[model samples]
Target chain A: MTDVLTAAPDVAEIGRGVLVAVLLAFVAFGAIPVVAGLAQFLLIPMHAVRNHYRETGPYLPNVAVLVPAWNEAAVLTASVDRLMALDYPPDRLRVFVVDDASTDETPAVMASLGERFPGRVVHLRREKGGEGKAHTLNHGLREILADDWMEALLIMDADVIYAPDSLRKMTRHLADPTVGAVTAYIREGSEDAHGLTRFIGFDYLAAQAASRRAQNVAGAMACLAGGAQLHSRENLEAIGGQIDTSSLAEDTVTTFRTQLAGRRVVFEPHARVLAEEPAGIDALWKQRLRWARGNVQITSMYRHLWFRKSVHPGLGGFFFGVFWFAILLLPVAMLLTSIGLVGLYLLDSDLAATVFGAAVFVPVATFVFMITMTISVDPRVGLKVWKEALLFPGVVSFAVLTGATFPMLVPWGGGDSSGWTLFVYSWLVLCVPAAFLVRKLELTRWGHRLAPLGLYLVGFGPMMCAITVDAYVKEYRGAAMTWDKTEKTGRVSV
Target chain B: MSRGRTTTDRATAAIVRSLAARPYRISSPVVLTAAELAARGGVLPVWADPMALADETEADRLRERRLVAGLVVAIAVVVLLWTVRSLLM
Candidate 1:
């Protein structure tokens, strides 16, 4: 009986040790995103050395501009006018607007544009519309591909305005025979900029200006920007001659297919295209949810391709997989890290302190490095959205980071047993839900006044995490995949 | 009599002069002359010097190198501050 009693304590101790080990593993899993993000950002500098410009030439081909329109009367006129005024050869450059049976003034506007620009602007009307962007694009692609005149096809959104030199810049990449497609940087060009637009501006700068540069260095791209993707004739036909309509991310599907077919996709940062983004939180949420869901779909669709070098080196490599999943599964990582930290604090305060104290510096250093490098990529946009950049991880999380980094400045008692430490540990788990609440508040009567403040407090990163969580839930539930188009007001200024 | 310089030749000369002047200073290895541009039936934009584009890429490379150096220095300073604080504590 005495031996059993003594053994009970030993067994309990062993169980406790096992739990601590498991929790620590969770914490380590959480650090994957932070480390992966830093690695990707570090790769951005390597683009200076490993770029495709050397292989590029002054290759200008007979380019057909494909504009897929559905109730885009508000922006089509300006968009068509801008296309007509592009610096490329007038005879070579033609605008093909595939009208998806608009009930609005779009048909009338298209007729006027057709008359105004005659042969330059050809209108292909889809009587039976509402099939989505890919179907509409394929409708036009069929016509454009039938005529052998189109040496290269430029697929762009109806609302985006291409810079005068953007087409020439993109075409230069296609000068290389091996290069399949090129994407231009899509800058948020809202004439009346708000906090939401400013946040989007920073997001674009980080995602396109910084991350895409890193992808260029790595010789693998995630997706071609839907607003400005330029494809060679052979590339389009090689990828089965039609955009993949099975997924919400047709651009990504096309990108992956092009790369898999042994052709390179390039990102030309100098080729800037201006796009009007969603100005409201609800609108932004809808758009991002679609993107997040698309990512989830792509993740499953390409399950066979990841981390397999034999299939393809760049896309299937370990680094690319880590980069892809770090963003895709970020929310889950945050939750695991939070749960682990909080559990550790409850189980053994001293050990928890030791682990957190050691782990904190990496994220802090990475955050600083990433922010500085990302801003440096596009200083003009960075200067405007510096506050948003800093507040990306939320004000409260930033406070925690600051305190953790400099314990002397914001002392949380020598031991990590303080309420402040516990709060810090719990904040990661809380932030996502709080972000969802912020979005919910935006739907309320006093939303206009309070939502912006709430968003700032919750931070854009957490809000994105919240949208990702929503994507997961909706995807699991097999919800309706309604194509909620973002209403555009032609607010993009050159 | 020397034939009057066509628009293409003038444009080509202008491009050559611009390349020779000031910062560009480098002679073109592959001159995409305005005759070629006119043959393609496209007028080159005022800023569209194909050779100068290569120079711009080189300039961007330099700028990126400087930025990376700045990043390294900033990271070092952060580490130094953290070390100092840890020691003082």
Candidate 2:
């Protein structure tokens, strides 16, 4: 009986050791995103040394601009005007507006544009429309390709305003035969910018100006901006001469195909394209949900290609795979980290506190590094959206980070505060659901007034994570793919 | 000192001359005088101008330097904060 009692203690000790190890594993797994994000931000500076501009030349090809219009009369005329004003060889550029059976004044606008710029702007109407952007683009692609006059095809949304020099900058990369495709840096250009729009501006600065530069250095692009992706005729033919219509993310599929087919897809950061983003949280959620779901679809579709260098070097390598999954599986990682931290707290509060104290500095450093680097990329936008950038992780998380950074400042008495510690540990998991609640709040009349405040408090990062979680749920349920078009009010100014 | 050359044209000519290494020339017919090009249904090829391209390249290089400088500043700030925290602790 004494031996059995002694053995019980030993067994309990072993179980405790195993639990601690498992919790540590979870915490470590959660750190992957923070580490990966920091690595990506760090790579942005490397673009100064390693970039694709050395091979670029002043190569101006006969470019055909394809615009797929669906009830876009409000913005179509302005978009076409901007295209007409591009600083390219006027004779070399032709605008093809594929009118997808518009219920608005798109037909009249196109007719007027056609008359105003005869032989330059041609309108191709689709009697049967509303399939998706890919189908509409394919229609124009067919017509553009049929006439052997086009050397390169520029696929753009109906609402985007290309900078006068954006096309030339993009075409410069195509000067190198190895570069089959090029995407421009898309900026959020809302004339009367609100808090949400400002947040979007900062988001674009991080995603495009900062992240795409790193992608260029790494030689693996995630996706071509739908607003401004330029493709060589040869590349178009190589990738089956049409955009992939099977997935919501046709742009991503096309980008993946271009890379997989041994052709280089370049990101021209200097080529700035201004796009109108969704101004409302609900609208943004729906738009991002489509993109998020598309990413999920892409993850599964290209399951075989990841981490296999024989498939392709950059896209199949470990760095690219980690970066890709780090974003796609962020919510899962957050959940695991929260569960582990909370579980540890329940078992051993002191040990949990120690682990969290040490670990919190990583995210603090990363956030600082990432925000500074991102703002520096485009100081003009950054200056305007600095508040949004600072609150990007949400106000509460930012507070947590700040407190973690300077523990002396926080009035926790440097004593036992289990309640506060538990809240901090659980915040990671709670933030996602809180972000979803913010969206629901926007639907209520009075709550709509407070939604912006809620967004600021919860943070855009958590909201995006929430959207990603929604994408997973919808995808798992086999939800019908609906093309939810964001309403454009011609608010984008050059 | 061409008869029809404006002050802008003269400046462009001087800039072109300064670039003796590449010896800039308006080789494309798209770079013809605006009126002449407009008569042929072509727009002025401002993008093809050698001097403009060079200026853009210089600007891009400057931006890259700025990015690197910003990164250095960020790292320095982070290190300073860490040092202060360590000292305090």
Candidate 3:
């Protein structure tokens, strides 16, 4: 075998070609999202220079802000108080709180708010629950539509605390007859947020604020933020006033429908709202599963609409084809690439090392460039909350090590294959919702900074993949639709 | 919150459920073909309206600025990683 390895030059050339081919494939696939993402950096100047912001000098049409609460007793009164304090005409603005049969103090809070605001607030309490948010939203839509005096409908979550000027900022967009819907920028309010929330905060900054700003420059939106969605009366009527209640992502479907009806959806950056997110891993898992499932449902629902120019030129072509593809499938692709690199390493160690350097070079380079660009948008997180970004390299390094060991398993002869298999299997199983588990391990004598790496890998990779996979499984099983609400603590930091 | 269905999704899902739940055993190839057939429409757009963006020179200049910035950062990262690798070695 040694002589054979030293001898055959033709076979060696063939092997080199195969290895190079695999390496290139991995690079090319990884580059798709990177290129698309980097291309948005061109909009930095556009976002800076353009006068996208419009001053609302008395452009507030009679607006009805709809808040759908399931069991949101914690933050209902605070949210209602905030809504009452919006910088719009008190006579023109109305607040509607739909308490979807909450057993909590939500009904009482709504009642109190109703008493406080009197004519300005309408509290509609439904007797039944668990019908999902789309149904609850449709209930609000029906109630609001009955009153023609209301010109624009604002759909917001119970936990969303809009800035005083948020309504006015979002309201000005509807002055442009072409603008159908406007969505506000959502910020995580908790100052003392944990690791997962910090990562998610960074993600929101990059993905939602930065990316959508770029998409807005192109005169389209990937989707509107559900928490602070503002829809014009005419636009709502154009796409059928009723919210469709059989899929996971009502907002995404509505975004597509509005654009298909030839009205632009604006991402109002100035209109900022603070919304609470799942604090723990299990809560985050369930929340993300619903979202991932909703996205899947939208993708399935809009199969005929994707990339179709005649009906939805922007929504079909760019958002669904480019943005959605990158967001949903990139993780799976990266995971596959990781596995492939491992397999390649097992076959040819030298070639694998070279390929590994290339793999590391691409992502790290892209990430650095991206962070540099996106950080300019949110310097606080990019600079101050920088540990997550700093530890990312560690995550990437461990991912490579874990991946290389993966192919060592699979019963293809003996060795430490069993150990490799055990590590991989244990990681996959324990990694999801393992932050608390990891915290305990660290407290016990032997753990170190490796705990942070565990949080990133297990939190970002396995847990995220589990969300999407679970969503797909449920979809395949045709599980009944239920608005599995994320629990809120009413923890709004001023 | 979930449950926001389109008519097409509802219909397609119904058809899939019906076919899968049938007594007759379906071949893998047939099922795959049917699935592909269902996902057939949707044409891509080649030309998108520039959305009232008239200043080509400005866009080009901005693009150049971004390109230069990206190159600088990429170089810095590669250099940083190489230095670490050298130090380790």
> lDDT of all the models against the reference?
0.85, 0.87, 0.66
Q: Native-contact recovery for every candidate?
A: 0.18, 0.35, 0.05
Model 2 residue A228 CA deviation in Å: 0.6
**Model 1 lDDT vs. the true structure?**
0.85
For model 3, residues A17-134, the per-residue Cα lDDT tens digits are 8876775576456556656665665464365545344312224578898888898889988888888877555667899888888898887887888888998999887898778888
Candidate closer to the true structure by DockQ (higher is better), 1 or 2: 2
| Candidate scoring better on lDDT of 1 and 2 | 2
Find the candidate with the highest lDDT and give its number.
2
Q: Give the DockQ (C-alpha) for candidate 2.
A: 0.15
Candidate 3, residues B1-89, lDDT tens digits: the string is 22345664455445435533434211111122443335534321111112211232234224324434534565576588656654644
Estimated TM-score for each candidate: 0.90, 0.93, 0.73
Which is the leading candidate under TM-score? 2
Interface RMSD in Å per candidate, to 1 decimal? 16.7, 16.2, 19.3
Arranged by TM-score, best first:
2, 1, 3
Docking class of 1: incorrect
What is the TM-score (0 to 1) of candidate 1?
0.90
Model 3: chain B TM-score relative to the native chain B = 0.35
- Candidate 1 C-alpha lDDT tens digits along A337-455: 99999999999988888999999988887787777877877788788888988888888889888888777778554654378888889898899999999988999997767998888
